[model samples]
Target: MNAILRGVRVIDPLGRLDAPGQDVWIDGGKILAIYHHIDAAGVPVVDLTPPDGVDPCVLCPGFIDLHVHLRQPGDDEAETLETGARAAAAGGFTHMVAMANTTPPIDTPERVAEARLAASNLPVSILQVAALTRGLDGEELVDIRKCVESGAVALGDDGRNSVSPRQLAIALAETAHLSRAVFVHPEDEEMIAQANGTQGSVTRSPIRPVETETRAVNLAVRALSHARSGHLHLQHLSSEGSVASLRRARHQGLAVSAEVTPHHLSMWLPVAEEPDPQALRKVNPPLRGELDRVALVQALREGLIEAVATDHAPHRAAEKSLAYDDAAPGMIGLETALATCITIGGMGGEWLATLVERLTVGPHRILGPASGVPEPRLRIGESATCTLFDPNAEWTVGETPLHSRSRNTPLIGARLRGTVLLTLAGGRVIHQDPARVPIVSEQVTSV
Candidate 1:
């Protein structure tokens, strides 16, 4: 694992480092040193220096995805822990929070422990969250204490929205004692049900309107205020109203954090008609109007919304191939997240570092101080987990050769402006774009 990344730009927000043309030395499993020049006489090297006309690749703290769906313990055909980890590494995520909404759901202490063990060996750390309600049925609460004790990073019922703010408040009250956060899918289920009608598709109908999310956010914020304990994390906020609610909640001194998804930020509803209409773009809290999309981007830039999660839900092709109203609501994003954000998010200059911070430090905030997830920084003695990406590299999304088992994303055939060139997790080379980086081996001497 000893190597030096040469001529790369380093961006570590927590460490207050944003420098270019630095050589980062990695030894064992931690960063050894960083300088303008490191003697490569005796160590393996990865040439991060781009060829003429190309921008130098960026090296930043290992990206953390706050929301991901590893359809394991049930739907393996769509995604397994191993497959999902592969996709994550490919996308430059050193850590990801796996939602607890599987077949049977990870609602018990035993299941949470099992999920951790199942992912223990993956290159990226999979922090599994426990279901807020048993079976995600929203009827009964799970053993929140035992689940957290068994190593669940947070509590959530993502696939199933919270039944009521009261239910969420009770769950928050329980997690408050544990010093953990409750990740709530802030969409009013009753409103969605009534709006979509029984058996109606969310995308086909008027959809889960902005009110569905804003109302839930307001109620959840009030619930958190009443509980007066525990951190409340709103997941995949897609509307201006939701962002405003979060701002108000934070202004009131509530321990609240929120995440936005790549799809919601880049894409919008009233999807353009293709030769053949497809359900690939359908998602819960379905993409709002263009104004909402613009608001999300601005919120992210201003740090009002803290994290950018992929909500990397993977479903079988058959599940996604259904009619617009009947198809599953999710898109595989671990592989496309970074590039999509850079391109569609309009990230550049100072905002680039801000985007990287959201991907790294922001998720850690939602995990809470008690989760034991390391602060993502590159420094002497810090773990050598980081990502190197070519921000100006243009690549089009293809229909085949995807790392994820699912191909439910609407970005197929769309050209993206950025791509990850290398991803290192704990000094391990989990992913590398070989053509761009040439690995050299030798014995290292003093610089």
Candidate 2:
């Protein structure tokens, strides 16, 4: 793990650093130094200097995913802790907040400890979230204090809503005292069912309507406002209504935050002329109209949305190949999140820097110290947990080999511009694109 990254552009948004042609020295799992040149005696070097015509690779604090589904102690045919960690590392993420809505549901202290132990040796750090309610049934609350004491970073019932705004308020109030966040799915199933039962009051499409997201956002925000405590993080926010609600909540200082998925920000409904039997693009808080997509991008730009999580729910091919309504409601995004934001969301310059901040700084701020994780930075003495990526590397999705076990991304056939070149977690080389940034004796010329 001890090596030199030569001529890499360092961009730590939190540190206000954006300097190119810098050499970062890593020794003993800590950043030894970062300067124009580092003359080390025994440590090897990896030349990160781009070719004459290519843009230099960018290095930044390791990415943190606020929300991801690593189905362990459950659905192993789709994704395990090993595969999910690999995918997160491949996507340049050093830390991932794994959701609690698993097979048995991470609702107890023992389960939380088990999950933490499972990911202890993985490349990426897994911050386990305890379910807000037992079995995620939304009927009874889980023991919040015990779970947090057992290493649960946050509390959430992500796969389903909290049943009612009042119930969510109660949970939030409890978590507020604990200094932990309650990540809500923010989709009102009751409202959707009612809307479907009625006519003309709501969109009667077979697919879930935008009103579902909007109403749920309003309810969740109201719950936060009522609780007047705890951080309420809305997951996978879609629709312009949700944006307006988030704007008002933040304006009123409600201590609530929200995240948007890559697919929701990039794609829209009815992408194909015919029905998709495999339901590749189908996701809970499903994709909306093009207008919704545009609004989501603008919301993230305006800081209404704090993070861009993968919601990396993986499923087996058989589960994904079921009928549209019966298929799973997520896509594997750990390997494609950054590229999607850059290419599909069209982020660049200051905006691109802002996006990186969301991936690193914003999540850390929301999770706070209770998450039991340190903030990643590329500075002297900081842990050498960082990512290197080529923003101009264009390649198709499915054409490349993904580390994840599942392949449910809608962008499978599309071209993406950015690609991760290397990833370091705890000073260990977790993932490196061998063909692009191989470390060999010939390439390691000392200064």
Candidate 3:
């Protein structure tokens, strides 16, 4: 739909549209024009300006998540492409990279193509991350060249840290030639198994240990040291030791980047101690100590962690209802990551606009040369790939589905300050809140 977004704060780093009270014209999947205007003929107008006493909103580059699992072609009961896409749009994401740890595991060209087809119709642009090793067995590398050419944005071996350092070094060396990225699920298997459902030794079942993540981070750093090409991306970093390692690596001039999940920014350890119903807290790396959470937040602020990825893992309620250690790990985050980051991560309005950049440009950098969406110019003739939200609008977590098939988020009853109002991908209205607290438009009606 052709529309004019009026008087909204356009917080774009590219166009220097950080100034508020501007107008944006979107048509034909591109930004037709951007200017200061009160009216335009023959087009609909979206008054992003708040009504009297309502908080103001802003338009920004739609969020780009570097890591997420859509659980399609396999775990539809957990989540499907449709629900995942809706969830992403609802979360203000227009582009996201889907992890390859699926039912059959997106390993081959054919599997990547099939995953692409499944995501093709979604409102969000979903890129597949083909398995780094065959079946994610971590024993042998998949066709790294073929996977990238076949539509995989990047390659990874997530869901477990069972990969051999020698094999992974071989994989990284091979991936260097492809000039893509390798996202490792940062953890050491032996150390974690040794933790045995408890970090401090009063063990019940096997759980992840902080040393496991630190060891994996060190190993990944060493492996990347052997590679002269390709990027090394760390996924869902969970500890202060992990952050310290990545930070030092960046200082040493390595082509490495890391991500922190929303949950890590919010929740602390003693995850296994939580009740079974909320057992989704049982993540692979597991939540860390309070010091770890503080360090992670500091890393985000200091730009040590390059992006905030949802790690948007979804699982069946029944699966999560199982015993804590026996339950599936990961809660849905595409819907709650932003709010969690804003509130739980302690990013208020002072850091608000910058967070949008971390969600958009930061992840864009993580995607690197493989992204299909051109970098934004925040000007006329650019693709109208952006998101809109009311920064001051308050709502309870359960007010909207955010379109996820799963209801596994831990923030269900928590109240949040900001709300995503609309999400546009290529000038099309992909998602909007029907029960949006009414906005007072000047001349045209709101969508």
Using TM-score as the measure, the top candidate is: 1
Off by over 4 Å in 3: 27-29, 41-45, 50-55, 197-206, 268-276, 435-447
TM for candidate 1 is 0.93
Q: lDDT by residue for model 2 over 178-286, one digit each (tens)?
A: 8899898877776766755753322122367788778888888888889878889889888888888888988898898888888788872232222344487678877
lDDT per residue, candidate 1, 41-83, as tens digits? 7997777777786667789988999899999989999998988
Q: RMSD of each candidate? A: 3.8, 4.2, 4.2
lDDT of each: 0.82, 0.81, 0.77
Q: Give model 3's TM-score versus the native structure.
A: 0.90
TM per candidate: 0.93, 0.91, 0.90
- Locate the minimum summed-lDDT window of 10 residues in model 3: 437-446
Tell me which of candidates 1 and 3 scores higher on TM-score: 1
| Count of residue pairs whose backbone atoms collide, per candidate | 2, 0, 5
**Cα lDDT of model 3 by residue, 321-352, tens digit:** 88776677778889887878877775656777
Query: What does the lDDT come to for candidate 2?
Result: 0.81
* Collision pairs in model 2: none
Output the better candidate (1/2) by lDDT. 1
